[model samples]
Target chain A: MNLAFRDIRHNLGRFVLTCFGLSLLLGVVLSMIGIYRGLVEDALTLARSPQADIWVVESDSRGPFAESSRIPGDTREAIARLYGVSAAGAITYQSVETKYGAKKLRLYVVGYELDRLGGPDKIVAGRSIVRSHYEMVADRRSDLSLGDRVPLGRNMFTVVGLTENRVASSGDPVVYLSLRDSQELQFELAPPAARREMARDEGVPGINTVNTVIARVSPNVEPDLVAKAARQWKHLAAMTQMEQEIILTRSVVERARKQIGLFTAILLTVSTVIIALIIYTMTMDKLREIATLKLIGAPDHTIIGLIIQQALAMGTIGFAFGALFISSVKDYFPRRVILQPDDGLALAVAVLLVCILASALGVRLALKVDPGEALKG
Target chain B: MSLNGSHTLVEARGISKYFGEGDARVDALREVSLKVYPGQVVGLLGPSGSGKTTLLNVFGCIVEPNTGWMSLDGEVVYDEGWLRSDLRRLRLEKIGFIFQFHNLLPFLNCVDNVAIVLSLAGFSTTQAKQRSVELLEYLEVEHRKDAFPAQLSGGEAQRVAIARALANRPRIILADEPTAALDSARAGIVMDLLRKVAIDQNAAILAVTHDEKIYDRFDRIFHLRDGYLDIEQERGVTEMTQD
Candidate 1:
């Protein structure tokens, strides 16, 4: 019989309890990893979803996600006429909070020309936005069903379609609107603010500002070359789609990544310490048995195997428990928890290594036990 | 003891052991010497500080004697220091130990407790199990083979302990106080079992004990006092002279 398993079998209740406790800890670690991945994925979604080859924004700006970058809405026309430009559209982005039913909801609003490159990549339900004004495509996370009319910026817009996994870097669900409506919503001041501005004789600029002018390059043309051409305009900062994604990750969500990574490291350290203490305690509990084992001439490897095997079993079972628990309830979390296969595999490997390292304490204690102790009492 | 010297299973000569140093030093064993032959159940009788257990540890390959000549199954295993690199393997092959408390692994059932020894000796699981069952059956505890250590009575646990000791068919069995925890009747039964095991397996049995109730069961008894062997008590019991 495998002695380690026999010992576990002998004390199954305690073993299971220990594993359950460990699983919850591991679950938190896994969730942090998932949340971190989700944060980056969310930050990159809008940049990637538009499927543009190049981005033309305000001069010297990393926007539209990392910072504010408002160019004239007419920049789309200039970008479209540029050499090698296949398609171009000006899009505006803003975060809005509004009352829906009795609940307050936050949303990320994106405005794009109907025939342009920027739009929700997929409509999982209902139809795409058909009207230039008063029609919207909302992410399912917003709980806006088809035909739901949500008031926004002095106008009511009907939800004509629904999307999934489309959210802002801050995790607010994204909603799509026609460029005309979005400009009105994003740049339009409240009636009182507008009146005050008019009374002060400061003429209200027309609501014609867009966060970014996204362009698709011709298949045979290099997007970088097109971006370089746009940058020569000096008043406009342009970047290829890859560069935009880099900015989003590095500027928009970098701190969150570092924070999550630090928390994960801390949790893993705590887990290692907890596992070490637990193994040490378990070894201490069985010191006599270990002594007897030694007295009976069991090999050092056998003793080491017993401790390491127990640690590994605990870690494996705990990881499975944590993974399953997190997977079953991830949707309930406000932030997306994306548990990818690769992440799980990596975590499993990490847990395996951690278990081995943690078991060192127990193995050391066990190896140090004097066989003569068994002959004592 | 001068048994047939050719059949001596375990022999220790001038085995001197000390603990600590200087003012705090203790002579746990002083020039102790003895020999046990196959099929003999030998008992070392002594008081609490008489060093019986220490001597047993030395013979069991647990403690390295500061100075000694030791042999098991006619092979020199320790001379002043361990002659073998792996004392554990040497012990596993030729020396079996039975603790006073029947230190069978609490987690393993009686059969596994016994079979683990054979397994450590490199027997296949099936072979180990088969041998363990035969040993348990021989000791009349086959019915309790699946019972864990806690479930066994003192006598039953000791019987299982004996079975484990015989698992690898070691040439020598060193039991420390095999019957100290047993009642007189139960102690007699355990002693009978040990004697039976010794004769049946042709293994030498050296046991340390303070219990005199089962004293008659041993084929030869040696008394120890103040780390010195009572050669007077051993003289009438064996033909070999203590050096």
Candidate 2:
């Protein structure tokens, strides 16, 4: 018979309460990890959506995600004229909040040329931007349905398609539209500003510009080399697909990753301390019993085994409880918290190691207990 | 049960034990010596701090004496104040201890508490449990074998304790004030059970106690006073009160 299990069964109330408390701690750790992973996914959503091999943007800027980089709309034509460029298009991104019925919705609007690779990677509902002028493909997270009309600037556009996990790094739902329409919506001055400009005899020279010009190299050409060739133009900075992904991932979501990571570390440390204190208290409670076992010819290994087994059982049970609880409520979080099986497995292994280390405190205390005390008691 | 009542199971000669050193030294045992034969129960009686517990501990291999020659079952297990064999294994396989408290593992039922010694002695679970249940049955605690220590009354717990002590059929049993925690009636009952275990299992039983009611139960009685031991030649009997 397992002494550890029997002891736990004998004290079921305390054991359950301990496990419940531990589960809450584990749940917080799991949530932080999921949030970090989700943040990365969200950051990569915009970057990964465009399948172009290289990005051409204003010089000294990282990219559209981490830093604002606007290039002339004619840069697409220049990039297309390059020797290894197979496809090139102009795209711009800007956040806009517009009145939809009684609700105000914030949306990340992206302008992509029809022939470019900057469309939503997966269309879950309706169709892609089929009509150039007033059609939009929106992330399902925007809560927009197909055929729903949304007012932007001076025109009303209809949602033509829906996609999932296509939100920006800040969790703003993305809306896709034609490059020319988006440029007009984002770059065009307000009527009052335009009136002031005309009165001042100043021309709106940059109204036709786009934030970025993306290009795809031919099959046999290297994107890095093509990107280097694009960088030769002093007016623009260039990034290969890998560099763009790295910048977006490292700079766009770096703070969220660190915050979540720090929170996770603090939680795990708290868990380890709690487990150590609990195991120590439990072992202290069994001092007499352990001493009796020792006095009665029970080996030291058996006593240590009992403590270690109980610690491991509590950790595993807590992990299971936390995993189930977090999985059930992940969708309720305002920010996406994606709990993948791999992260759960990794956390479980880490918790188990912490348990083993935590149990050492109890085992050491139990080992030092004098068996002769049992003779007196 | 191949015990020949004439053969001595345990012998300790001139065992001297002292605590501390020099000016602060105090002798706990002063050349104490005793021999126990199979199929008999010996009682060690003393007031508190009379060195009775110290001698019992020495004989049980829980502590080594400053100077002593000790043998169990005709083999010298300790000499010159040092243990000559594995004391833990010797305690597990050759000697049994019953404490002031029953000391049954509270989490384990009566049968498991009894079976653990056998299990630790390399007996398979099935064999250990079977032997343990049979021993409890012989000790008249079979009905309470499934009950945890807390659920059993004082007499029942003591019976289970005895069952645990005899599970391995050890040659020697060392009991320290085993009846002190019980009422006069329960103490008599526990003493009777210990005597029965001694005779039936062909084992030598050594018990330390102060209960006047159960004085007549032991086959031999020794008294301790101020770190000195003496065999009581004659004693008076008294009627044990029952509740």
Candidate 3:
């Protein structure tokens, strides 16, 4: 009964071909959105897993995630002495390449106090790093199973615990180590340098330094107040957990988000133009038919409805196909592609809006066709 | 033949239509006066650009004439270059148009092409389709009702279009070169069908064509030359038979 559906059915092959092209374009757009979201999720997972309310870093620094901020490991005790600070732990983060078997595995090595507010939030396998040295907990994505021995700088550690989906914003799997061993490994001096320093009457080698100190405020006290109180220490800068996340997302990965956003806008604009051109061409092909309809006294709204109905159908069909395509092959992608249902719904709505906007060109062309053409035509 | 006599269904007096502005202007119709009576089939003949199409447009209420007094179904619809009501609604409710080509919607089948007019007139889909079947059967194209416009033969397509024009049961039917695409035999068939429809429904019909073979089929004929009336003819039954 609907003219749009009738026309599409009449030209089923061409309609399907157009929808396929649209679906491929929509699939790429959806993947970009997923990549952007996945980066944000990866960034947040590590921040949320530690469950610390505040971070205390070296003075005049943005913290370890955004920039290097090495402070004395004893800063944990200073932050723990504050009134509302229930727990504090010195933490270090560094990217390291370790050998699994024959392949090199890149990991985000996180050194945390085992008894304090830093470690994996959930353990799916054996146990947390129990030994003070030569013990590790690996994320499942690292392809390391429990009971495997991995060699890092100057030591071989046994993987005792396993976690899943714990990764850095760069998509590297996270591996946990005891705070002491991590600090020693991160700032270890080469044997030659150590002997040279000894001959030159230098002090002890760099061993007791950590990237930052993480703390959790007592439930009754506001974390912001504790952070502000800790800021009074001239040797350190204290930030609440929310502030650290803002820094990570807004400053640390700001450029990536902006580039992806620009690409998304260009894709959407291209989609709109392509749809307009296709619909306009379709209207042109039926110029005489439209003129005849006009001469037969068809209302303008009816003609408009034909164009918009076709547009809306194409958009809805294309979005459905795009969502299916991205979800089915997302795992094959090197980086995580997280497609949430809300984002899919939002994209569907956007596609519909674009379709409606694109149909305007066809509607304008159809309305401009003079009914008088049917007389001699 | 509802009253067994002539009753005016459409009247146009001194209707003029001009295009462009000033030095570039050209008059398409120059004070063209015309009448169509119920149960009659009128023909308009002219060479190319002689204003026959313009006059049809004026009668169909598609283009406003520069100067005109037009009445339809006893209502003063157009007076001196303006419409008294919505022209689109007037055309939908009271006038049917058949073009040079069949002009059937290519996407729709023959039945749907006819039923669309009834749907536009506010009939439910089921009612419109039922009425469309009856109309196509009346035009002797019931067997081709389910075929798409592209699938239908030329003669069949024209019959479907005529059925569509009559689907609204309007008081007047205006056809422009309706038989131009058909051969002599097919053109005779279409001409006969038009005559039958006008007499059966008591509706006035006006057709513009240049088919000499079908000249005797018209109840009245008007010819135009250089945007002016050139000749008028009305033949008796005996003369029509002789032709």
**CA deviation > 4 Å runs, candidate 2:** A98-104, A154-156, B1-5, B21-24, B234-243
True lDDT of residue A366, candidate 1: 94
lDDT of 1 by residue, A1-377 (tens): 67889899989999999999999999999999999999999999889998999989999898888889989878889989999999898999999998888988899999988977899889999988888889999999998999998989789999999999999999999999999999999888888888999999997769989999999988899998999989988789999999999988988899999999999999999999999999999999999999988888899999999999999999999999999999999999998999999999999999999999999989999999998888766
* Top lDDT prediction, candidate number: 1
lDDT against the true structure, per candidate, is 0.90, 0.86, 0.87
Q: Which clashing pairs does model 3 show? A: none
Compute DockQ for each candidate against the true complex.
0.82, 0.58, 0.62
Candidate 2 lDDT over A65-139, as tens digits, reads 888988898898999999889888899999999999999999999998885767777898998887789889988
TM-score winner = 1
The best-first sequence of candidates by DockQ reads: 1, 3, 2
Per-model interface RMSD values are: 0.8, 1.2, 1.2
Indicate the TM-score of model 1: 0.96
Residues A285-346 of candidate 3 have per-residue lDDT tens digits of: 88887888887878899889888999999998888898899999997887778998998999
For each candidate in turn, give its C-alpha RMSD to the true structure in angstroms: 1.9, 4.0, 3.3
lDDT of 1: 0.90
Q: Which wins on TM-score, candidate 1 or candidate 2?
A: 1
lDDT of 1 by residue, B1-243 (tens): 556554678888999999999999999999988777788888898888888888888888888899979888999988878888988888888888887888989999888999999889989999999999999999899999999999999999999999999888888999898998899999999888888888888888999988989888877888889899874344343554355
